[model samples]
Target: MNDFFSTTILIATVASGIRLATPFLLASLGEALGQRSGVLNLGVDGVMLMGAFVAYFVVLKTGNPLIGAAAGILLGMVFGLVYAFITVNLHAEQGVSGIGIYLFGLGMSDLLFQKLVGTPLPIMPFPEIHIPLLADIPIIGPMLFTHSLIVYVAFLLVPAFTLLLNSTTYGMNIRAVGENPAAVDSLGVSVTKVRYSAIIIGNGLAGLAGAALAIELGIFQHNLTNSMGFIAIALVYFGAWRPFGVMAGSLIFGMVAAIVLQGKTLGIIPRSASDLAAMAPAVITIFALVLVANRFKQPAALSKPYERGR
Candidate 1:
């Protein structure tokens, strides 16, 4: 009986992990797109933080969660625009500029939170949407189908991203730019334009991830992601720049997190050990990177900005 119960708990934990990983999967997929287009936006953390704060506040003010989601998308687009200005237009170092954007977004989010909400009350959360038939399954039902709309959107994005990268004309252009910007430039395709678009789209996805963390999880605290943003970025590499691979990596990390948190609650693991378990995802990411570093080949112009001669 005890072993059976433990097995059930472990199965449930894995299911929950996939749900938790949805945000990471979505964020990393967006980053992969940008990286594949020759732009590396490190401001992903900041973008997500701002998106969370703004989306939560919007929901509170409007009494509509969908409005909050819209706010998240809009803020994400703005974050992308800022990244484009600093890196794409100014010919700045993509890595350094991304760090600057991260700092700016973090400070801005904190300032806005202090000014608007005064750090007193809690922000409202989004509602769940249960799938008709699928949500009725034994253990998998609630775990997969009964999440908020954003969760479903995240899962859908994996295949969508793969299809976009492998089957689209724009994706072809993006690949061309990443592999060899000079060749793309020679063909009259503006490398900067392609990179800028990727950055904007990637940052927008980061924002959505942030909003999901805050509104879906029902908290709007500072540094709410707890370095999940950085982990998402790392997962992109662990996934070897592929959307499906990123999804798999995110699911694994998410499950580890769920097990740690749930195990503490269930007394299967002590609270201290559970805290330690939170480090599992990061450790796994580092290990994966070490193992696959030699096999991975990033975009040729990932960190380079295109500068056309006058």
Candidate 2:
């Protein structure tokens, strides 16, 4: 009886871990999509911040989480267009421009939130949908299938993005632009257009990730993402620029964060140790990036300024 109970508790703990990890998984998946197309968007943090605030306000005012989510994605698309215009079209330095966008997002989001909602605002939570058939299963069903729509979407994106990158003509264009924009340009594929499309799609998905965080959590606070954007960025490299890998990596990160917090609450681990453990994902990400960098080749024109004629 004791062993059985222990096993049950362990499984529950892991389920909780995955639940917490869902947001990062979504954000990382979005980032992975952009990176695969050769545009490294360091502005994910800004986009996330904007998404969170927009979703929260829209939900509070309209009492419709769906509208809020849509607003989030739309705003993200607008932001992505800006990023693409500067980086892909004008050939700005991707890294530097990304930093500028981050700063702008940070200040703008904070200011907007304070001006409108003041200190903080209450938010509506999403309903969990349990599959009628699968929800009845013993342990596995409850652990996996009974979750918010966003959770299901995050997992679905793993296979979905994988198929997108491997099986479609658009995927071919993405790879071509990322791998060699000049070559694609010579082919008359419009290197700028492809890159722009990737950035917009990537950032728009990132917006949904932000909205999911705010709506799922049921509240809004300034800088709510808590550097989650950076973690998502790190995940892109850690996952070696692969969709499925990003999902796995995000899960590991999310699980670690959930476990650390829970362990602290349950007194299973020292409270002081919780902070260190929370750093595990970022630390592991650095190590993973080192390994990936050694073995992988980055896109040829990535971060390189593009110019037309002499």
Q: For each candidate in the order shown, give its overall lDDT on alpha carbons.
A: 0.82, 0.80
lDDT of 1 by residue, 166-203 (tens): 89988889888888888888889988788878888888
Pairs clashing in candidate 1?
none
Task: Say which candidate scores most in lDDT.
Answer: 1
The TM-scores, one per candidate, come to: 0.93, 0.92
On a 0 to 100 scale, what is the lDDT of residue 255 in model 1? 77
lDDT score of residue 284 within candidate 2: 69
Q: How does candidate 2 score on lDDT?
A: 0.80
Relative to the unseen true structure, what is the C-alpha lDDT of residue 13 in candidate 1, on a scale of 0 to 100? 73
| Model 2 RMSD vs true structure | 2.2
